[model samples]
Target: MATHAKLSPSSAVRWLSCPAAPLMERGKPNTANSYAAEGTAAHHLADQCLSFGYSPSDKVSKVLAVSSKGIGFFKHDQPNKKDIAFEYEVDQDMADYVQEYIDLIDNIMAAAKAEGFFEQALPLESITGEKGATGTADAVLITDKEIIVIDLKYGQGNQVDAERNPQLMMYGLAALNEFDVLAEIESVRLIISQPRRQHVSEWTISADELKAWGETVSNTAKLIDSLDETSDLTDLFAPSEDACRYCKASAECKAYAEHVHRTVCADFEDLDAPLTVDDAKYDGDTLAKMFERIGLIKEWIKAVEQATVDKLYAGESVGDFKLVQSRGGRRKWLDEEQAEATLKAMRLKVDDMYNKKLISPTDAEKLKKAGTLGDIQWNKLQDLIVKPAGNPTIAPGSDKREAIITNPVEMFDDLTEA
Candidate 1:
């Protein structure tokens, strides 16, 4: 935001949607979480793997680079996969995921070898996405005919698609600009490896198309620079679900407030009082509008609450609505160890108090704070993930999620059997 490309390629979806976000979020403190820290450690391990061409051994330190030897030993164990991971004690699923990355690179290289390009092709390199961007690409494979820019997403929070990915395109353009033989690289392939989701998506475009996209990135950078130096940003900002969801300026932005105001004010231009859904008379069109705007309205409300909390923490108050604790709520064990000890002393059946039943890998993944569910447990759960047919529901055709597939014959068989 300080005259830099704060609209980085990784955050292009956000800044592009809300042009003035870079300056609006200036001077905000970043709140780092354990997930981000774990991601960083994973990225460090991946970068080291790329650099050294080896995987860490089981003896690699476990304390997440808090120790000197942790980093040193991680670097030392290069190129093979006995115990290669971000954390020292990785889950089996995590091991498989890391191995997937390694296997993917190998597959690409092996394919290149089969096609006879491995000899002259430049080896894959971990690269900064672009000259002006503050992001790095996990790997880039360069050849005379094609350039493949790859990103590895370690977190399972959400699956990322490679199709028309601005992040990967920026990486491709950056890699293109870095290499001298740009003309030889005819096409670019963008790949996103989300091993946890088992979703590896790829998108491809001509080198000319990728170069044209670079113009967009350059323009975005310029726009950010202009916004950063602007006096008043009232007109420059625009708010939408994509832009406002992660913007640090949610609490202070006037544009978003105006958006909320317009949405509600227009909805109730004729109403004398707050109209409940039961009392409201709306057509299909109005109902659809409400449906679309409801999500955004909820988001705004949540952000407003957080902003209020932030101000309250600093000793500010909103009239008489000061923060307070309810007299009664759900209770918990004051001492978890003592509670467990008591349960053991009583000889209570563990299954009565604890869930001994199997849970889905997705559910089991919630227990993984820094690593996988540990050892072969997750791998065993992998076979148990029976993705049943999803219930059919109506949605707009424009929705990006894949439509559910069903077998007519199977349905007919069920009816006949019944």
Candidate 2:
């Protein structure tokens, strides 16, 4: 078996939605991006802080490197495949965000300990009987009646909710399986601490509910394994925005392409027909439907464009399209100090070469928290802070913010003023 499972918990949402995704994504190259690398680095920092009971700020200025063998706080000289490695510097921003996650864990631990004897579990490994249904949890705290499994999401993209989340459910199942022997666990609390988004989401479910979900997971795994090389997968794949967002085969998947086509070119008679603007007057209902599916459509378009570019780069022809140089070269000083010195030697004015701007209100609040600004000064400055009314934009009805209402009297007053 491979070290990483085919039905990994991280990809649980995708695979569970599109049952054939694991098989279809075979041999697809999994490339790394800077965002993923940074997230991994943040996870490593959090792990270190939790393990050693040190502040994330303590690791500031330290380099976290990843080689082919695996990630670690190692030197750059470590040999690896293709001499390839990624390094991330521990910065103040990352430290602050990770400290929030650590603080959340500490708070949970304090409360759990107050209740009774609580045992903390690190690196909760999967012990499931189902093949390829393994995962390792970030942290797990087990008490007499409850188990808390916390997952730290460093990505600042879309906010991740914890309710009925497959990844967290898998982690909850693993934690229960690993530590239920020690404690009589009744309920599992899954927490997703996304410090980067400044959002923490949690959900609690009974232990029996988690085990029942586990059985469904096992059945899904069995369904996935039953597929042979010659089996038809037409009905096996179900594509949706969340499921197809990170699927490796999304670029070339026929079902996904068809889904996007239908989503964008709705009201058309033929699903495979070419799209044209002729007689295309979309109704309000049609427009709303398209808007809802716009994210998936945009993702599919981006994936197709990237795939074309990759093929072109690999000496393959993508119709009449070929790679061209883009207007992306923006020059910068190679050495800031040397450039400044040369500029000064040329009699350049200091004010002409430098920019001075006021710190933002947010940063000022940070200074106040850090004790750099006195309470009186901060209070005085608070009077100068002005927040403009946000512009109205489209949002779903489920949004927590109340709808902005334009009062008829205020509208008449504005018109009179005008």
Candidate 3:
């Protein structure tokens, strides 16, 4: 089966909305950063565990080269084959993340069976959605009357809501087309399992409604196909904070720049001049307005900074700023196994050389559930746990948490100290 990158379910939410991004990002370098490598490795690990029950050894070779400059693992004649060639190497941190993903799928399967949501046992692995429209779902549970699509997200950067998610909806659409179980799937269930943030978001829609959504996705794909390769699409941008955050061409994309600048200027136009509050204590209302715009502004600035670095690396200067390393790279032991052997020969206790291990609250909870820790022990362990209050965050007044208040004198004292 073949798939278009533009129609990929993972990128559907962004690309469908910002129709210009697909072409805009094409001209940029396809370099893999540390984060992308880690994510790829994590996904590969999850796939291995899900499909073949395989796990990597502690000293296994890295999947993606630390310095590889090519786009993905392979450059096949078929565009879809290019996606298959790339598999990331998993480090200990990535392995832990992969385990969380595995556990979530296991739980979802168990819940489906226990709740009698499925007629047969959960499939050994997820089934592909409509390749032409939605790409593939991570896991699919087909019941007598309903079909469930599950996705595992390892990144902790954002909490993705599963409600009316374009990607999942597309995945649902794809699943409906490919699978024809006995009961006839009447409803489509979408679940996004994000273990890093300890979130499992779920949403569902009728099969008819999902198919209706599929028509919209099909139309979007058709629109993408209809674009003239020689023509410019700078005016068709549907820009947003989430859409532009990870866009490779965000810095140079004219539509994105114009959209942000125009929106910001218009929103703040009626405000007092100078854009800065002259008062020692800014009013809550003014700060609230600033807060609404700050997040988007910060996202735009970060994208531009990264894009600037990428351009400079390719010998394209960003005005007066020249490219330079921020700091020297850290040195690592060339031979870790030999280093371990040498350390062992030196009579250094393992305890002295390695840090003490401690599991997180979530891990402890899992262990307790597995009966590794008895109820009494678990209670004692829970008693030892301490959770510090989170630092004050600036959020909308409509937030559920009580607004943190500060005394005027304390505020002044802090300002004087600054």
Using lDDT as the measure, the top candidate is 2
- lDDT for model 2 comes to 0.80
The ten-residue window of minimal lDDT in model 1 covers 116-125
TM-score of each: 0.66, 0.87, 0.70
- lDDT for each residue of candidate 3 in 256-355, tens digit (9 for 90 to 100): 7766675455435453233333442446665566567666678888888887887788899689999766787798799999988999899998788778
Q: Write the per-residue lDDT of candidate 2 for residues 300-376, one digit (tens) a residue.
A: 98889888988999999888998989987889999999999999999988899899999999789767867899999
Per-candidate Cα RMSD to the true structure, in Å, reads 8.6, 3.7, 7.4
Report the CA-based lDDT of candidate 1 relative to the real structure. 0.65
Overall lDDT per candidate, in order of appearance = 0.65, 0.80, 0.66
Runs in model 2 lying further than 4 Å from the true structure: 74-84, 114-133, 268-285, 362-393, 406-413
Runs of candidate 3 exceeding 4 Å displacement: 53-93, 114-134, 180-182, 229-235, 263-289, 327-379, 395-418
Q: Which parts of model 1 have CA positions greater than 4 angstroms off?
A: 1-5, 49-61, 65-90, 112-134, 155-159, 180-183, 227-232, 264-295, 324-385, 390-418
